[model samples]
Target: MAPAQYLLAVRRLRADETTPVPTGAIAAELDRSPAAATEMADRLAERGLVEHEPYEGVVLTEEGDERADRLARTYEILCRFCRDVLCIDDYEAEASALVGTVSADVAERLAEVLLTDEKAPSP
Candidate 1:
């Protein structure tokens, strides 16, 4: 799973990433097992993406926050593309499901198209 999921959960639980967010809460938010959440949290910490507290929870490291923010932006762009461009009914959900799966190149291309479309004069 993408580390951004954990970051998003923490942000959803509370905006501030400095505060500890319990692993159980994360598991519940992501609908995964506690062990899985812990495992991912540990992996994130190893990558300097997050700080996993043994019993308490995890905190988003500075790098984690930046990644999360970037992911958020990408998600929004994807949502707009799916909705306004592709006419998908469940754009937000589709975008949310694509958080980590979409390639950066694809995301950039989508963003470019979105920008271009927005700038284009209406037909």
Candidate 2:
């Protein structure tokens, strides 16, 4: 999936925390223009990452949570590699831009290395 789409999915999951995440709450958290969060939420629902109920907050489906968790883990691993091995502190933002283009094999390889490298800096 595209990085922005993944981010939107993750954001929606975040919004579905203990307290029901209001559309306005998501909008504030994402700092998006008015209704942008709702629109993104709609797209996420269409993708099965989130489900919206009339007059109620959004919730993540089991599949949605799993996918979001996987994306988040992959992104974290990417950031660690870009920072620890590549000596880049701005890895989070850079990795965010590159995550979409990174191949699954490459991400898995990077994740393996990051998991084994005890000294790898974690974000």
Candidate 3:
């Protein structure tokens, strides 16, 4: 949702400059326009989260990668919860519902609880 989703896409698709993720690819992933992806990329560049080359592609900066990794992990945890708790069969359903709704802090807390619960010895 919003710019943060784009950051996650960039990190998941291309975390390194050696293999940049194309705007077209990002657009496809986000179900947005190429222009939309490029614009978001530009915005992210301004924040020093990514390097966007018009023709080359976009790659996440170190900070961007770290942030994106956190977002991606949060999403995965949410997805797992959806499947295991809510019994949602479609991941997209979970994604579309949870995207933008959850905050980083909430996500991290949820992750800690879920992971801790998962690791608790089943007595």
Candidate 4:
């Protein structure tokens, strides 16, 4: 989850650009120490999910980008469910939803229901 979140953050920061994302930027986004962010980045790089260059920051590999996007969408869907269906607060919804795993198919179904249900809150 941490890796996916990091990738999503980097992807958001690099939207419409291919420039490498700075470690400091990632650390700031994740609210982690620079050293911790770098360590995680290194692990991701080892798995071929990202390319981490010392002092040059990191860039998500193709696989990482796709997974990150999926994770972000799943998170959004869960958050919406929590907010509209369960009446959870925004902050709690986001945090609570991510703490548990939700499969892509389940998330898609939830999103479909949210979109089609008359009583669902506006997206």
Candidate 5:
């Protein structure tokens, strides 16, 4: 859930061209209730992953940004694998890939394998 929220926050940052994203935007991105999003933000703040100010917004700490980048890449790799290799539909692939239990090493290896295989011709 933290990963998911981080992704959402990253996306919002990219789209809005801002540092701290409004809590409302985060809530909208996650399709979560505002209270839930605020609660999550507070938890992330406690963990030193984000800096949150009531009625102001939240921004990821440097460590949080790094984690979010890795998580996003892992998610993309998993989604590609599910869609291309497993032949799952896009929607299902997106949802199913949220089971991001793999370590960073595993995710990097999987991503490399997927890229290499993509360049290989169909046999």
Candidate 6:
């Protein structure tokens, strides 16, 4: 899946745990248009990330849960790196910029160091 789509899937799956999120909810949360949200939902459903319950709501499958967990962890590590080590004031922007470019090896190394160094100042 494309990175944006992957992030959308993760966000939708996360919403499911907290509330019965409709497609519109996803769109609003992501600041995407309704059509885009519908399209994203269709793609995610095709990939088994979610199941459509007709008029009910969407629910995340086990595969979606695993993927979202991994993505969330990666995002958290990037946020820590940008805010703690790099001393970036705009952590969200910096972290988003790094998410797609950072290699898994580098992310792991950063995660290791960040995990070990708990005293780093929070942004």
Global lDDT scores for all candidate models: 0.77, 0.63, 0.75, 0.74, 0.66, 0.63
lDDT of 2 at 115: 54
Clashing pairs in 3: none
lDDT of 3 by residue, 6-68 (tens): 987787677555688999999999899999999989999999988888987888888887777
Candidate 6 TM-score versus the reference: 0.71
RMSD of every candidate to native, in Å, equals 4.3, 3.9, 4.2, 3.4, 4.6, 4.3
| Overall local distance difference test of candidate 6 | 0.63
RMSD of 4: 3.4
Clashing pairs in 2: none
lDDT of 4 at 22: 89
**Decoy 2 TM-score against native:** 0.69
Candidate 4 global CA lDDT score: 0.74
1 against 4, candidate with superior TM-score? 4
lDDT top scorer: 1
Q: Which one wins on TM-score?
A: 4
Candidate 6 stretches with Cα past 4 Å from truth are 1-19, 54-56, 97-106, 119-123
Superposed model 1: Cα runs more than 4 Å off: 103-105, 115-123
Task: State TM-scores per candidate.
Answer: 0.80, 0.69, 0.79, 0.81, 0.77, 0.71
- 44-95 per-residue lDDT for model 6 (tens digits): 7888887655444456667876665555556668888888777999997666
Clashes in candidate 1: how many?
0
**lDDT of model 2, residue 101:** 71
Model 5 lDDT-worst window of ten: 114-123
1-123 per-residue lDDT for model 2 (tens digits): 342544444555463454445666666654664377677767878888777664565676677666665566567677878887788979987777776577656777776665575642332
lDDT of 5 by residue, 75-104 (tens): 666666677777877744463346347666
